[model samples]
Target: MQPTESKGLSSSIFISRCRAVWIHIGEMSCSSYKVKRISGFDPPPARVFAWRVLELKEQGVREDDAMAVADMEYRTQKKAKKKAYKELKEIARSEGKKPPPNPYPSAIKEIQAEEKKYVMDRLFNPKVIEIANKMKEERDKLRQDRAADGL
Candidate 1:
C-alpha cells in the first residue's frame, strides 16, 4: 500500500515522510523545516503577575518578597473566580436546571500547563529569571542607543 494510503497514519508522520521525499528530490529547502520561536507577547495572567511584581519592586520590596506577594495575589484572584463560579452553579441548581459547566478550574489548568511548557514561573525557574534579565538588558541598551541617536 502507498504510504499516503496507509490507514491510521498520523498527520505528523505523514508530513515528515513527505518532507523527506521532497528533500531527496531537491524540491524543498532544509531551512524551511526550522521551528519558529514563540513571539514575545505575554499571556494575560503572566502580564498581570509581572506587573504586580514590578510594582512591588518599584516600591522598594525585595525581589523575593515582591514575587511572594504577586504569587499570593494571583492565587487570591483565582480563588475568587472559583468561588463566584460555585455560587452561580448553586443558583442554577436551585432553579431545577442542570448546573452550567464550571470553566475556571479547566481554564486555570490549561494556563498552568502552558506555563509549564515555557517554564514561565520565574520563582521556580532560575533559567527564566536569567532570560528575563537578558531581555531587560537588551531593551535598556536599545533605549540608550535610540536616545543617543536623537530618536
Candidate 2:
C-alpha cells in the first residue's frame, strides 16, 4: 500500500480512492446496494394503523379521538385520508352505483363565471375602453415613428 501523503489530495482524488475501497468491499459482499420498493397496494405497517384510524373516522370518531388511538404524525393523517377516499370509491364501485358528482362543481362554475365577467368588464367597460383606445393610438404612433426611422 502507498504511504499516506502529508498534503491533502484534491476532492476528485479523495473520491476515487474512497470509491476504489468501496468497490473492493462491495465485490466481497453477498449483496451490493439494493433499492427496496417504498410504495405499493400492499400497505406498510404504518399504513395499516392509519387505515384503522380512518375506519374509526368513518364510524364518527373525532379527529382528536382517532389521533389518540393511532399515535400518528400530522403528515401521516394524509394516509388516513387516502384510506378513506379509497374505501369510498371502492364502495361506490362495488355497489354498481355511479359516484356522486363532486359537490363543489357549481362553486367551481360560479368561480369561472365570475373570472370571465371580471375579465370582460376590464376589457369592455367605459373606462377600460377609453384606456384601450389610448393605448392603441400610442402603439400606432410608435409604429409610425419606427417606420420613419427605418427601425
Candidate 3:
C-alpha cells in the first residue's frame, strides 16, 4: 500500500484519474463490491390516496368525482337508512297507527326566521337601499341639530 509517484501527469490530474478508475494488473478492480436488489415494499395510505387521485385526474376525471368518492359509501348508507325508515312509517300507517306529528319548525322558530330575514334584508340588500337609509338618517340628524341651534 505505497503511494504511487506522479511521474508525468499533474498531481491533481493523477488523483482525479485514480479516483475515476482503478488500475489493475490483469484483474478486475473493486471486485469486493457486490450489487443486490431490494424487495418487500409497501407505501403509506395517504401517499397511495394522493397517487390514486392524481391518476384519476390524468385520466380526465372531474375533481368533484375524486373528492366525492371518499364519502360515497357513507352517503349510500345514510340514504338506505332513510328509505328503510320511510317504508316502516308507511307500513305503520297502513295498520291505522297514528303517525308522528309533522317535523316542521314551530311557530317560535318561524317568527324568529322572519325577523332574521328582515335583518339580513336590511344589512345585505343592494347598496342603493343602504345608501338611501344612511342619507335619510344623516339628514334627520342635521335637521335636529339646526332646530336645537335655532332654539
Candidate 4:
C-alpha cells in the first residue's frame, strides 16, 4: 500500500465511525429524552403531585378542583402515616422495647426544620431585627444628607 492509499483508508475508517455515532444518537427518541430530563430534575413529591392531578383531570375533574383534591389526598396520606408511626412508637414504649426507627424519615422535614431555625435566629430574633432597623435608619439618614448636599 502506498502512503496516499493508506492515508485515504484511515480517513474513511474515521469518517465511518463518526457516521455510526451520529446515527446511534439520532436513533434515540426525542420524547424519551425529554421525559428523562424532566424526571431527572424534578423532585419525587412534585412528580407524584403532578401525576395525581393528571389522573384527576383524566377523570373529568376541573383543573382547580384536581389540584385541590390532590393536595388534600397528599396531606391525608401524610397525616395517616404520622399517626401510624406514633401508634407504633407508643406500643413499643408500653412493651418496654426500643422504639422502632421511623420507616418514612423525610429529608424535606429536616431541611424545613433547619430553615425555620435559621429564620428564627436571623430574621425574627429581637436583636437581629433591631440591628436591621438601625441599618435601615442609617441608610435613610445618609440619603437625606446626600439630598441636602445636592440642594
**Judged by TM-score, which candidate is best?**
4
Model 1 poorest ten-residue lDDT run: 17-26
Candidate 2 TM-score versus the reference:
0.31
| lDDT (Cα, 0-100) at 122 in candidate 2 | 83
- List candidate 3 stretches off by more than 4 Å: 1-67, 100-151
Which pairs clash inside model 4?
A: none
Which runs of model 1 end up more than 4 angstroms from their true locations? 1-43, 105-151
List, residue by residue over 45-111, the lDDT tens digit for candidate 4: 5555655655665566776887788778878988999999999999999999999999778889878
Output the better candidate (1/3) by TM-score: 1
- For all candidates in order, the CA lDDT equals 0.60, 0.54, 0.51, 0.62
Per residue, candidate 2 scores C-alpha lDDT tens digits across 1-151 of: 1222333321111113111111112112212222234665554444444445555555667746774666554347766766676677789989998875443235578789779987998877999899889999999999999999995
Clashes of 3: 0
Q: What value does the lDDT take at residue 67 in candidate 2? A: 49
Model 3 scores a TM of: 0.25
Give a tens-digit lDDT track for model 3, residues 43-70: 4333334344434544566656753552
Backbone atom clashes (below 3 Å) for every candidate: 0, 0, 0, 0
Best-to-worst ranking by TM-score: 4, 1, 2, 3
Best by lDDT: 4
Quickly count the clashes in candidate 1: 0
Runs off by more than 4 Å, candidate 2: 1-102, 106-110
